[model samples]
Target: MPVISYELPDRFVAGAVGQPGERAFYLQARSGRRVTSVALEKFQVTLLAERLEELLDEVRRRGGDDAPVPAATPSELLDDEPLDQPVEEEFRVGTMALAWDPEGEQVVIEAQEATEGESAEPEVGDDDPAIAVLRVRITAAQARAFAERALKVVAAGRPPCPLCGNPLDTAGHVCPRQNGYLG
Candidate 1:
């Protein structure tokens, strides 16, 4: 397996490209000149952000006020920049793992490449050379920034219909609550 690991990367973020409904989401990590971008579904990005927040909150609660984790993303750490240029996808993420490193006081995020017909659970210690992983280690503040940005990116998509909660297209969409009428 090829692992692209960034330890305390200079930049790590979630961003998207293209218009509203047609957008593609990506997770990017850059350290010095080396950059790694991984493709993933919008839902994946949303879940990652939500989970990261929950994880950080739990850590803070357990560690009390002395924890390095912050209640919010520090203003200086808030990154609103777009994904790095080229936006080349190294791999499509299949499974993702997140953890809080107590010793390093960092959040570790690992996105594993998706494989066709792969087992639901990744085997421990299974070295599959075909699989590629993008691993990024970032401070709690950085993680919070990333999550906040990711949620914004996801929300930037097409607006949802009030009737059915389905995304509305530029020309409108058929809403289930409206009996398939364009709403």
Candidate 2:
């Protein structure tokens, strides 16, 4: 009946209110058009669930001569929908990249091993091995936070390149990379 959608800031499903010593109603969102019903504490969950259930029942009863049956059961009230994809967490160290995938809903952590101190050869000898990959699943909330943090980091701007800490300006500088130093 009542559908609850939670994104960034808030996370909650719609439910019904109850009188003193009475059971309240709750609706957990399943899909775009369906919500399952459950009982909850009054004044805590929203009343929308009860309202939608009443409306749906009324419509069903009007269409059919027999009593309208509920389409779902209380056990199915909780959401079983597939969760959103996780966001990638990347750290840039010099030219190397370390990354991991994290699930926001649960506490999970993964790390990428350092690739330094290795020979230039790509071949893996008996002792040396390739680096392992890290994968994580993060909730929508986690994704949003990650994006926000990246934006802030970019806004702060990066330290001058170690090769040239000073401004290049239009004159440019004399470096092996360049033809000549115009300064």
TM-scores, all candidates, are 0.94, 0.22
Output candidate 1 Cα RMSD: 1.7
Off by over 4 Å in 2: 1-110, 116-137, 158-178
Per-residue CA lDDT of model 2 for 96-141, tens digit only, reads 1112222222211122233566444332111223453222223323
Candidate 1, residue 21: Cα displacement in angstroms equals: 1.1
**Candidate 2 lowest-lDDT run of ten:** 92-101
Number of colliding residue pairs in model 1: 0
* Candidate 1 regions with alpha-carbon error over 4 angstroms: 122-127
For model 1 the local lDDT of residue 163 reads 80
- Cα TM-score of candidate 2: 0.22
